[model samples]
Structures are given as C-alpha cells and as structure tokens.
Target chain A: MDKGIDRRDFLKLIGIGGALIVMDTGRLAGAADNKMAQDTLSFIQLSDTHWGFNDPKINPDFAGTLRKAIAQINSMKSQPDFIIFSGDVTHTTDDPKERRRRMGEAREIIGGLRLKNVKMMPGEHDAGLDNGEAFQEYFGTTHYTFQQKDVNFIVVDNASDSTSSIGDTQLQWLSAEMEKLDKDSRIVVFTHRPLFELYPQWDWWTRDGAKAIDILMPYKNVVVFYGHIHQEHHHMTGHIAHHAARGMLFPLPAPGSVPKRVQIPWDNDQPYKGVGYRSAVPKKDAYGYDLTEFPIIKV
Target chain B: MTNIKYLLRIMVVISAVVLAFAWVHIARLAAETQTVQNPVANQGHEQVIKITVKRFDYTPNKIRLKKGVAVTLVFTSLDRTHGFNCPGLGVRTDIVPGKSNTLRIVPQKAGRYEFSCDVFCGDGHEDMSGEIIVED
Candidate 1:
C-alpha cells in the first residue's frame, strides 16, 4: 500500500534536453517528422472494462459504469489524443463463439468515443482461453510499437501466452526495438500485467518479466504502465517506474494483503473507490509524463 | 445545377481536410523505432556529493549523475543509524553519525536506482530512502 519510493519527483528531475527525434527510415524526413515530436499530446489509459461480466453483488451497475467512463472521456474539454486500454476488455468466456460475441459487443461500446486512435491489447480474460485467437481477430497484433512526441510507445502483449510470459518471440521483437533507441531516448511501455513480480500467487508477476527488464535496463528514461491489479499501485524495479491502473469493472484486494484475490463487494457509499483510469500529459518543463487518476462518471 | 456542383465541391474540400488530419495521426503512430547511429558514451568524469539521512526521510532525496561516471556519496546520519540499500543497482551502505560512510558507484547504465535504509532505525524506517538517477 505504501509505494515508499518517490518516482514522480525523480522523473520530474529528468531533463528533456532537446526534443529527441527519430525519423521514419526513408520517407518523411526533416522538420516534417518533428510535427508529432511535440510533447503536448495527452492520452488516457482505461483498463479492465471486463465487458459481458455479470456479477451484481460486486458491481451492480457494471454495464452502466463502462459506458459512463467512455462518456466521461468524450465530455472532456481537452480530449486525449489517444486512449490505450491496458487489458481484459471483456469478461473471460470459455465458449469460443461467446468470446467473439463479447469482443464485438465490447468493441461497439467503446466505439462510442468521438476520437479514434483507441489502441487496445489483450488480457488473459480475453486471450488466455484460446492463446489470443479471439482477441487478435478483433484487435489485430498482440504486440507492437508506435511513437509520439519523440517518445517511443511500445505495447507488449504478456497476456497472449496464457502463462503470462512475454514469450521468446515478443521478447526478441522487444529487444530489436530497444536496440534502435538512443540511450537517452524516452520510452513508455504498456502491458496487461505488471512486468515485475508483484505477487506471483495472485498472477501479478509476469513469467519472464525480469528478462524484459534486463533488456530495457540500459535506457535512461523508460516507464512501464500496466493493469491487472484492480487497485492503483506504484513500484520501482531499479530505474524503471511501474504503475498499475485500476480496473473499470470492480476492484480487487491488494496482493496477498488479503486472504484471497476476491473483488471487494460494490459499495453504495464509494462505488468508484479503488477503480478508475489514468491520463498522462508529457511534462513541458521536463522530459517524462505527468500522470493523473480520474474516476468514472456517475451519470 | 451550378449550385449543386458548388455544394459537391465544398463537401470534397471538407473531406480532404479531414483525411489529411487523420493522416498526420496515422503517420505518427506508424513511425518506427530506429537504432541509434551512435549511442551516447556511457563513461564520464568522476564526481562527489554530500547527503544527510534522518528519521523517516533523506535530505535532498533525489540525486542525478552521468552514466559511467565514478562518484562517491559522502553520507552522515543526523540521528541514530540507517542503511542505504539499492539491490537493483547493487549498491548499499550504512550511514552512522560521527562515522565515515560513503558509496562509490560507476553506473554502467542509466536508470533510476531507488536506495532505502535497510537497517530498521525506528518506526519511520521504511520511509528513510533516496533515489540515484544515472543519465547518459
């Protein structure tokens, strides 16, 4: 519960120097490429909507909550440039047809957004049942890379393997990408589960996360944002700052802090407690992201 | 008929603007990560810093240094005794009042190594910590 370490302040101290730039191999060189290199873009990360989930005791308004969260982002005066759903977009289903149906329904629900660029990866709930066959059909590519504001954004699919390993294939893809960046270049990684072993018993730890960390260990400014834990948490694996986003569905107990990994019964008093989403604004004064948590809209 | 043609022309213009706006976003997202032609050199000159440790916290809790630079952190405890343990970076040391203690490190890589007091000094021992940032 006590994050103890002070990463927010430490990251603020990381100087941006100048806008770090990387041109597309051949086409669109020069200042034309720098258009997106500006650090003013902001994005929101909404995780674990768990569409098709039906548990009134834990979340009576599960369906309503999911829509309202999207509406809340839609209503923002300054709409985010992008949205990254960390994982578990739908409730886990054993039936193959049902899984695709849930994915379709959930995609339609999230499609209500006014903006596009809604990037999503899979979670064990969506992928583990079939090694991501259902999810990839709807979302395409379990893992990939993109860039914004001179900062490289990588989405690593740890959920696809079911065992929660980055897998040798994806890890090699990650290493190849890592090799391309300058040591001082800024990088932000997104994963469904925590990259470091937070609580293996509770499935918080990635099977081969340490190896991924070793690959990313050399970078000067690399931050990993993930979801799986239903509650907000922050931890430090050396220099890399790992922050977990709360689920859009229901909240779970802290790692082994409780007897079981059960969801806390929905509270009428604090319906949105231990649950919400995160928005990150690239700090203009410095080099890293300034992250803030936002609650789901009640209406 | 001329009015109808004009309306069609206006619609085409609006669509083009919309299409162009979308392309910028697509292109940005499409941009690939490339290997650095010449990565920054890791090694730098040596440096030194003075730090103070106390109950529940560390003074100047954040320190920044260049990667591959050898540096010594001269530490002194204001109260009893505390420890600076950074397992990630493999750097640890004890801070004792009226005693000489220091951590000499040459960070081969750039990272945010969070060091905390390993020895339990008091109830506030957990909060007694600081960060060492090695940059390229």
Candidate 2:
C-alpha cells in the first residue's frame, strides 16, 4: 500500500471505477445486470436495534419488529454486499453475559436471513459498563479499516471512550492508514456516535469527534453514518456528509424540541406510525451521498 | 472475701457490655429491615394504578386520582428504557426492559401532575408523554 493511500480512499477509487463503468453503460437495466462488471458494491446500514428491550409503554413486540426489519432487508431483490449494524444493540448494562445473550439473540435472528457478512459497532448503551469491553468481546474489534474493491470502509468505535475519544492509538492508526490511500478514493466512516455535535445536553455529541473529523477533512470523498439519536438526521460539512439512522427500538423526540427526552408512547389505535427507515446512495458528483427516508407502516 | 467480690464485679461489667452490644446490633437489624413509613400515612387512602411503558405509547395515558391519595404504581417497560417522572410529585424511576418497577407516590397537592419517560427510547421519545390528574 502506498503511504498516502488509506483504505477509505482506496475504496472510493474502486467506487469511482465502478461508477465509471455504470456511466459508460448509461442504461439503468444494463447497469443493474452488469453490477459486478460495473464494480458497484452495496451495503446495508441498520442502527439502534436495542434488542432484549421489553417495554409495554413503547411496543410489546420490539424484538419482533426488529425481526421484521431484518426480514425486509433479506427480502430485498438486490441483497446488500454486507450489513452494518450501527450500534445500541442492547438497552442498558455492560454485563458480559447479558451482552453475549443479546448478541446471540441478534445473531440468531439475523442468521435466519442467511446474509453473507454482518459488521457491527457499539452505542453508548452497549458500552455502558466497561468502556465497551463486553461489546468488543462479543463482537470483534471495535474500530478497524477494510477495503472492498475500490471503496474503503472505516469502522471506528466512538463508544469505547466516555468522552468519545478515538484515542491516540486509533488516531495514529487512522492517520497511517490514510497515508496509504489516494486522496480521490471514496471513504465511508461508521460509528455509534455522531462525529459532529447533534445535541450536547442529551449526550448526543461525541466530545472529541472534531479530532477525528479534522483528520478526515483532507479526504475528498468521505461519508459518515451513525446511530445513537434514534432518528433520521443528515448534514454536510465541506466534502463529508453525516447521517444518523432511525432506531428500531422506539422513536425519540428531536433534540431540545421537547421539554425533556421521553419514550414516545405507543398508540394502539395508530400502530406502526412511528418507526422510520433511511436509505443512502452515492450522489451524482461521486463526492457526496444522498439519503432518502421512509416511515415503516403496517399495511 | 473482698477480692472475690472484686472479681464478681468485673464479670458483671463484662456481661453488661456484651448484652448492650447485642441489643444495639439487633436494633440496627430491625431498623434496616423496616420500610420507611409514609409521612402522610393518615392523610389519605391507598389506590393502585397500572402504568405500562411500551413502544410508542402508554395505556391509560392520563391517570386520574384523588388528591392526597397514596398511589402504588406498577410500571413495566414493554420494549426499552422508559422513565416515570412526575416533577410535581418529585418521583423519578427508570422502568427497565423486561422488568417491572414499582413506585409509591402520595400526592400532596390537589392539582394535575404530569409524567413522562426521561430516557430517549426512540424516535417519538419526546412525544411519548402522559399526565397524572389529581382531583379534590
């Protein structure tokens, strides 16, 4: 690997190459049929499942709802190349046994989908007890970089520290990793906490996320996705776009909009009105990402 | 004879100290086990209310009761973290997932008190709110 070519930049190069193939074809059907030839890679991002949570005040069938979401993903005509669970897999406590149990249950449910690969990050809830030691034990490395084709996927663990510090080691690793990739490569950063300040009072912002963003600023094609706020929010700063996914567990109020944060109560008469789903795709410029969100409703 | 009396007095003192220590220990245990008595014990009668915290909503969202009545609320979280907070009543407790959290509240004033989940459970978390109305 070249010193300036990071995994993300490399992945972006692959994405660009893939997009170029599609652009050359200039036909949707042809692009779809020749996806592999086009080098188009797709991945699913699911966030804030909050498994093992049973709250009648919210929904009695939270787990079932999550299963349905998984089913929806599995049933998609074009299966994602991989699945990324943004974070908050569990409600509270950092107990290893409980964490393991929840992870097992999630795996079992997702396993039925028979997906090829599932990658995960931890949310604050998942990292409540021991700085995500239990979560890391159940899942693999919290933060890592992977390259598929020409796109670089950087999975960082913001939940590992209370102040949301990427830590010196991870920062050094990221810097060195970025040094290996070309600046034009497309990069995707995934974490449980939003890299920018979403809402500080509710502990929504990562304290040291600016440090991570500072490092990523030099990259031309960078996109970040996170799940902790439990709602769909999108923003852009310079070349990077930030997106937050809707939580599968329940719906929360927007920051500072409510007098205080509370679990949105369930209305039996109006079931399935609160949940939402977010989808993203590479923008036309190939330097940004566009998002579309739909609220999940019972038919 | 005088020396014998002195020995007897020492044994008596030792026995008295042991008895006092045992008495204090037993008293402490009793106090630890005893439930804190309601200050308004004779102020009103007891009432039972069931509050369910589930995904999206709460059943019987509006809880109505008589003022000064002792309320025993049985709360349970249906899906995730739900908080039962009545700032007026100064009551706050987190209803954990899969477990029931019981609370005893004796409203001191004759007014409408509001309650909501403080934890950010999901998307509609802010809208997931309710109230407690106390009548005369």
Candidate 3:
C-alpha cells in the first residue's frame, strides 16, 4: 500500500508480483481475491505478425520490428504474466511447406522472448485451409477455455469456414462453458475476427457472431478482443464490450469508406511509419472498458 | 511423269490451307467477344482519378473532390491483392496483382469518406488506409 507509486506503476508491480505468486501457488483455483490484494495479472497482446513476409515496401527489417514489439513488451517495468498473439501469425499461401516454414520462423522468434506462457488464435490467413489444421498442429487447439483469477478467458476459433464462423459445435461448447461459470465472474473472449458486423461485403465479420454474443449475454461482465481489421475500434452491445486491435503489420482502411478493400501502401516520408499499440483498462462504470491507442512507428 | 513429287505437293498445300482457315476462325472468335470493360472508363465525361496500391500504402492518402461530380477511379495493384472501398459512397473494388481495377462513383452528399484494404497482403496490411473528402 505505498502511496508514492502511480496507478500504472502500481498495476505493473502488482502484475509482476502476481505472476510470481501464482507460479509458487501451483494451483490457480480459489486464489482470486487473495491474489488481487497482493498483485494483479496483466497480459500483453500482439496481433497479426504475418511473419515470413519479405516485402521491401513494408520493412526489410520486418523481423527487426517484431523484435522491437517484443522488446517493448519485455521492457515494461512490470513484466506481463503472459502474452496473447491474437491472430494472423503468417501470410496466406497454398504451399504447406512454406506455411510451416513461415509459422516455424515466427514461433522461433516469439520463443526467443522466453515468456512464461503464450496463447494464440488463428486469423483467416492462418486458417486459410479449412479448420486450420496446420495452424493447430503448429500451435495448439484453435479453440479452448481457461481461467485466471475470477475471469473466464475463452479463446474461440472463428476463422473456421470460408466466412469467419464459429461452427455449431464450437457454439455448443461455448454455451456449455458459460453454464459452469459463476454469476459474478468476468468473461474475456478472444478471437481473430470481429464478432460484430464491421463490413460483411469484404468478409470482415463473423457470420455466427450474434449467436456467440447471445451465449455471453447472461454474463454481467464480458469483454471481447479481436484482431483482423488491423485498426483500433471499440463497440458496446448490452453488457459486452468488443474491441479490435491494430495489427502489427499494415493497416486497412475503414470498412465501406474506400472504393474497395485494398492495401494502403507505405510512404517513406511520413512521420509515423510502422506498427501500432493499444492498452485497455476496466472502466469505473459498472459495464464499460476503456482503451488507449497509439501508433508505434519505427525509428 | 512426277507422281511422287505431285502427291507430296498436294499434301503440303492441303495442310497450309487448313491452317490458314483455322487461324481466321480463331481471330474471328477473338474479335466477336468484348473483353472485361473497365468500369470507370464507361462513365463518359467523368472526372478521372488515379489510385495506386503498392506494397503497404496508398499514393495520395487523401482524395478531395467536389460533390455530385462523377469520379472515375483508375486503380492498379502493384503487388498482391488490395481493395479500395468507400462504404459511404457504396464503392468497393478489389485490385489484384498484374490487373487494373476501376470504378465510377458519384457522391451525392458531401462528407468525409474512409477507405481500407480488405485483403491481408503482408505484415503492414493492417495499417493500410486512405481517405476521400467530398465537398459542396
């Protein structure tokens, strides 16, 4: 209870302290409020890395930029408990060997970080071949549920079909998972596609997102984070707050604003060049999430 | 008197005649069908605008024009797949590698319009964005 520490610093300290304590506790079960009193578990998100891309127009130092993101995350005075790579781990290609090579390289780079834990979800690019069997093989289960403190963290594989979709089986699994959670538990969901309709014409939305939303409606505190649009966007529906993160790669124009869905090329003369970052905090309001965003340019 | 030579000559003449006829037939088929028309070029007297989509950025990040003026956007993708989309103006076109895409849009109302690539081209794919400004 040091009064001198600022709020962010205090949170960071708590996060680091909590991670250490959790590591010692061995069992994360029933240690919620006790852990909260001593420390808080804060995690960092890195999305849409699209590794193995060698476009000189982006950054001949693309790998270097990724290393920068990792460095920034690691340099946080209070290290994050874990890191989640939201999606798009690699560029889309038909060659299986090429896909594996790209993913393997990305994994090696991320593994170089030596973090305690890392979680990932597949984007349309990663899941280009049906249910993302290759992605799952390289990574792990595409959809699964986990718990940290009193929060129920559900990572869903929405990039299951041609259009971003959480198949009926996944939906059923989601429904069953929610039934077991406590009424007061906070729910944080992650996916690679926007759960809400951003732009259907360009396939930016999940076809069965409304159904997934319906499943979470019973929860009082629900927050959903997705990465695909590659821009920072926040929307609220009932008790749920949906957020889309800026991509680590390039940015896309706002939906329906451009003549077509096309890549906005790079300009060398611009002051701000590459990468973006977003931070979110639980709002003071009973049901709200506040996000602060900024562009991370290469030097 | 020269039956073998005459027979060989006859075969060669027949082969040449067949090839000539086939060539004309193929040429006729090619001329009969019109190629895919450039959508923007079809709009006569429209204000022509050029848009270039390269690796990770758009050439004129912002486009400004007068309202109600017909716009003919001629776009080409320098690299992979790129999209030019303006939801407000109901314009969405995809530019593929080695192909040119064009669209004709007439904005009736004056406002700020945003455009972005829907394709995941590369690492910087998420940051690709541009804008169109329509004024009265």
> Could you arrange the candidates by DockQ from highest to lowest?
3, 2, 1
Residues B91-130, candidate 2, lDDT per residue (tens digit)?
7677887776888877777876656654545445546667
After TM-score superposition, the amount by which residue A276's alpha carbon in candidate 2 deviates from its true location, in angstroms, is: 3.9
Q: lDDT per residue, candidate 1, A3-68, as tens digits? A: 211223222222232223111211122121232234467778899998988889989898788888
Q: What tens-digit string does per-residue lDDT give for candidate 3 at A130-236?
A: 45878887898888998765567899888745345688989999999989987667788998898887785556877689999999988888899999877777788
- TM-score on alpha carbons, each prediction: 0.60, 0.60, 0.62
lDDT of 1 at B116: 65
B94 Cα displacement, candidate 1 (Å): 42
**Each model's lDDT:** 0.75, 0.68, 0.70
Interface RMSD of each: 16.3, 7.8, 6.2
**After TM-score superposition, what is the CA distance of residue A120 in candidate 3 from its true location, in Å?**
0.8
Residue A242, model 1: lDDT of 89
Give the RMSD in angstroms, all C-alphas superposed, for model 3.
11.4
DockQ of each: 0.01, 0.06, 0.08
